[model samples]
Target: MTRVVFVLLPEVHLLDLAGPAQVFAGADGFGQPYTLDYVAERPQVLSAEGLPLVARTDWPVLGRDDLIMVPGWRGPVLRDGPVLHASAVERLRAHHAAGGTIASVCAGADALGQAGMLDGRRCTTHHQLQDELAARYPRATVVRDVLFTTDDRVVTSAGIASGIDLALHLLAARHGPALAARVARDMVVYARRNGNAPQASAMLRHRSHLDDTVHRVQSLIDTHYAEPLPLSRLAAHAGVSARTLTRLFAKATDGLTPLRYQQALRLERAEHLISQGTTVESAAREVGFEDARMLRRLRR
Candidate 1:
């Protein structure tokens, strides 16, 4: 089981804590293995909205697969917010040093910086504080106007609601796009992409449905998007006739054929590989396209 720890700070924004927590919890509800835990410096914490929260001060043993998250807080000014003690900062740094992933939302980036986790890392925060964060942590590369940025196992997000996007991205990367989409659909949200990717995420683009048959087909396609999946094979997996499966898929996903959905997944993955410096031909082959010609045309 993966342990997800949320470190609470004084005046913490309720949404920042609830958004990612709910995402992970919802994933677990869908059969994913995750144990949520909340920790803070004190036995109790207060929210920005003036609500009181009880938290634990005792820490748990975390491993490489575990995650530690910091949610943003409120303050009169960006710099005047609640401050974390040196011990807490050290805890965050030690977790990352031990190969655990550490993430932050909004002003929680400040805590990460104090831990030295943001140094030399590409990260982002609320747009309003981007410049101040950059100036405060000169060694860190602060990206702006983005949902989230992950660098060297450290994840940072923009404002409050972007925390959902960050959590969904993490889930999709760890598991696959299918389960992430399921969790998103369950939460009634669009699984938007992280960073500045203009195209819709394959998870979100194929979502918006209630048919279990289409969902079964989508699960197979999402997990093995790089394989040659025929209509007959998909029909067999869904236990339906090919014609019926086509009609169901079209209706569930807004007129997208099963082949088109697979193509979208392949193209999305290929674009990701190319963006990471892969050659067109290599990306095409890796994504199950026989040649670069078709992939090029799709990209255009």
Candidate 2:
């Protein structure tokens, strides 16, 4: 079983802890063998939302597969940061040194900074705190306007609801995208959304619409983009005629039809694979194209 440990500091945001906690709980419910534990310097810690939370004063022994997360609290961060016990800070640093993953949400990056994990690593926090995070951790590369970032084993994300996105990413990497998608569906949320969407995921760039029909179709495409999904199949899933589905999709997404949107998703995934050193032909085939020619045309 994988042990997921949350290091709770004073005045933590309820959602920053709850959002990712819910994701792991969902995974465990699906029989993924995740055991979640919470550790804090004190027996009782108050939430930023005014809820009281009780936690364990003793930490569980963590293996390399285990995870440690720091949820953001409400503060100016640079002005008055949450006080982390020096021993707790050492646990954060030691876990990473032993080849484990460390993650943060919003101003939680401040804790990771104090643990000295963000040095020379790419990280991000909420837009309001990104400057403060940068000013405080000048050695770290603080990416702006993106939903989240992962470098080595240190992960950081934007503020608030974006913690869900960061958790979904970890689930995708640890389990698989399919299981992560299932958990997201169960939670009635999408895995990604626009913050500076173009820098995020294809799933985020085109999800700014409110039509349920278009959303249903987009969800289908998001999971099976690498498969042979024809327009008729997608339309049938949306319970609309192909022509009607095309019209609705275009109207919702500023005139990009279902086929075009699928191509965009495929193109985005292909670009990511290619950037990671996959050959154009291999990337094209992996993304469900007949060959590299169409992929080349799309790139141009």
Sliding window of 10 residues with minimal summed lDDT for model 1: 191-200
What would the per-residue lDDT of candidate 2 be over residues 1-300, giving only the tens digit for each residue? 999898888889999999999999989888897898988989999998899899999989999999999999988654597877898888988899999999999889999999899999999898788888889889999999887888999999887788888888888888887778788899999443423333445577689889999999999999888888889899899899999998899899889988888899999878767755689999999999998999999999
TM match of model 1 to true structure: 0.66
- The C-alpha lDDT values of all candidates are 0.88, 0.87
lDDT score for residue 261 of model 1: 94
* RMSD value for candidate 1: 10.9
* Per-prediction TM-score: 0.66, 0.67
Candidate 1: Cα lDDT at 162: 85
What tens-digit string does per-residue lDDT give for candidate 1 at 134-168?
99899999987777999999999988888888999
Residue 233 in candidate 2 has what lDDT? 95
Backbone clash count, each prediction separately: 0, 0
When superposed on Cα atoms, how far off is each prediction in RMSD?
Answer: 10.9, 7.3
Which has the greatest TM-score? 2
